[model samples]
Target: MWLDPFLSELQAGDGLPVLDLGCGAGNNALYLTERGVPVVACDLSEEALKLVSERVPEVRTLVLNLLEPLPFGDGTAPAIVADLSLHYFHWADTERIVAELRRVLKPGGLLLCRVNSIRDTEYGAGQGTELEPGLYESGGRIKRFFERDQTEALFANWTIEALEENVLLRYEKPKRAWMVAARRDWA
Candidate 1:
């Protein structure tokens, strides 16, 4: 998992419940819970949240749409995990969602996320109609692929702890993505 390297640092802070944004089936949520960390798993699908709740009864699940404002208060979350979730949006929506995430995170809190890389051909990078430079619409859904500069621009307001491109084999084919750990430094 992309969060493994940052687990120690995450556990070192106050025991605030981590917000698992776009938590599909609770993969990252389950990982955090196994290590004794509290998690509030949020997703757009009710069925997905149901699966997560069934798998881990202790996890709190909420149905949330990223395009809308998050329900949490400002600076409430100590950390958040958005695994492969932020890519499915237009540029403006992506920016708005990220800003919302920043607004909810505490100062110095971390946002650990993985987004589709421009080189991710196996999972559709340059396919379908191009909505923007790196954003594409295929199969009635939008997906945004980020170059190094794009990721830098996306988290320009935050303190980027780590950003690296990697290939994940969780799917039938290899999926290329950028793993980012950005810290919210200002309120």
Candidate 2:
């Protein structure tokens, strides 16, 4: 997860925890805690939560299904990390989750996320059912790939700090993805 360049601007605080949404494998949780930021890592998979707990006992872990309502109170976090986690929703659910992220963050809070790109041929990107533009239902799972304009429209309400296309070797396979660093500038 890309953290330093974007999150370096924020002032970390005890009242403002960093939420690791869909914190699969706990790598990002480890990253946050190592940086001395308190983190509440959440995921839908019990096994994933278990891994996080085992690896970083200090991180508070929650089993969260992102499609449902989030559990945090308003303005609870100063930073939210959704590494490779926000791309697997239908269009409407995507909007709600984005709004929820905004609602829970303090004004000027940062959100860093990565989603599968339409150019991700390495991960079976273009082989899914067309739910909507750049959204697909592949292998019984809903996956949404993002275009640059689509990403801008999705987070138009926020100050888009950084939005770019990049590729990374995930699980030994090169996966194309979009990285977005945005901030809720106001309530």
Candidate 3:
């Protein structure tokens, strides 16, 4: 989907490793593999991992709990992509996830993060039970929407390379899109 073009920027012949955080059903992971990037597909849902394995037999899949710190060493990967995943954390946990992302990313690595922004259309709102004070529930998951500046502040250390907000017109309804790419300082 929408991440396909963004992922194109990270492909490097057998040299780049990508961590597809919260890789739901492995669609994006599979897509990256087709482009020749090694992808480590990770998510909290066992069922989702099972489906991904069945669909993309070649993909490397891992079960991950976003609430817990990531299981990766420092500078282990060159690029990390998390699509529609960060919103799952409550406002308080945002920093932890950001730090975990930074931890696994190599110096000068690139990170692409897609989350629900506060300006999303009502149609993008969730229907699940709320676990946090302001977050909503959807797909048996908890998520929160962020304003542009709020999201930027979460990854303050990185230099933002690109930022785009898209409003998807799907079936006469709008879907919010918040896409950003930032680089970790090489030092």
Candidate 4:
């Protein structure tokens, strides 16, 4: 889906390391691996990593909890991508995770993030979807929706390259979500 465009922006011979945070099922990992990109796919679920390994053995996967500090050295990766998984963290934890992500990424490296929009219809502002109270279920996991400006403010230091809000349909119903991209400044 959106992965192709994101991948298209990356140069083939960039030779920079890539980390896929919350790489569930590893579909993107498998696709990127086939393109000769070196990717470190990580998730909190061992079972999910195992499944990804069985399906795409070439992808390097490690068990990781995003709430804690990242396992890589500073400026280790040139590109970091977390698709539809960051919302699981509370606002405080989210700040730490973003800081960790910036710490790991090289200067001018890209961070691609996709999160649910607050204007969602089906699972937008409902009681059943919230993990605690304010959050909602964006997909198979619990998430908190955000306005465009809120998302931009989360990474205020970085330069936002693009931001888009779209409705991902489920069984012919529109589900509000957003895809945003930002670049870490040279430090």
Best by lDDT: 1
Model 4 ranges off by over 4 Å? 8-13, 124-142, 169-174
- Count clashing residue pairs in model 1: 0
What are the per-residue Cα lDDT tens digits for candidate 1 across 12-76? 65888999999998999999999988899999999999999999999999999998999999999
RMSD of 1: 0.9
Against the true structure, candidate 2 reaches a TM-score of 0.94
The predicted structure with the larger TM-score, 2 or 4, is 2
TM-score winner among the candidates? 1
Ranking by TM-score: 1, 2, 4, 3
Stretches of candidate 1 exceeding 4 Å from the true structure: none
Candidate 2 runs further than 4 Å off: none
Quote the lDDT for 119 in model 1.
100
lDDT by residue for model 3 (8-40), tens: 567862475699888987878888888788888
1-187 in candidate 2: lDDT tens per residue? Answer: 4677754653355545689999999998898788777889999999999999999999999999999889998887888899999998888999999999999888888899998899987786788678888887877888888999989999999999899899887568888889999999875
For model 1, where is the 10-residue window of minimal lDDT? 8-17
Question: TM-scores across all candidates?
Answer: 0.97, 0.94, 0.85, 0.86
> Whole-model lDDT for model 2 versus the true structure?
0.86
Candidate achieving higher lDDT, 1 or 3: 1
Name model 3 segments beyond 4 Å from true.
4-8, 13-16, 123-134, 137-141, 169-172
**TM-score of model 3 relative to the true fold?**
0.85
Instruction: Give the alpha-carbon lDDT of every model.
Output: 0.93, 0.86, 0.79, 0.79
Model 3 lDDT vs. the true structure? 0.79
Model 1 TM-score is 0.97
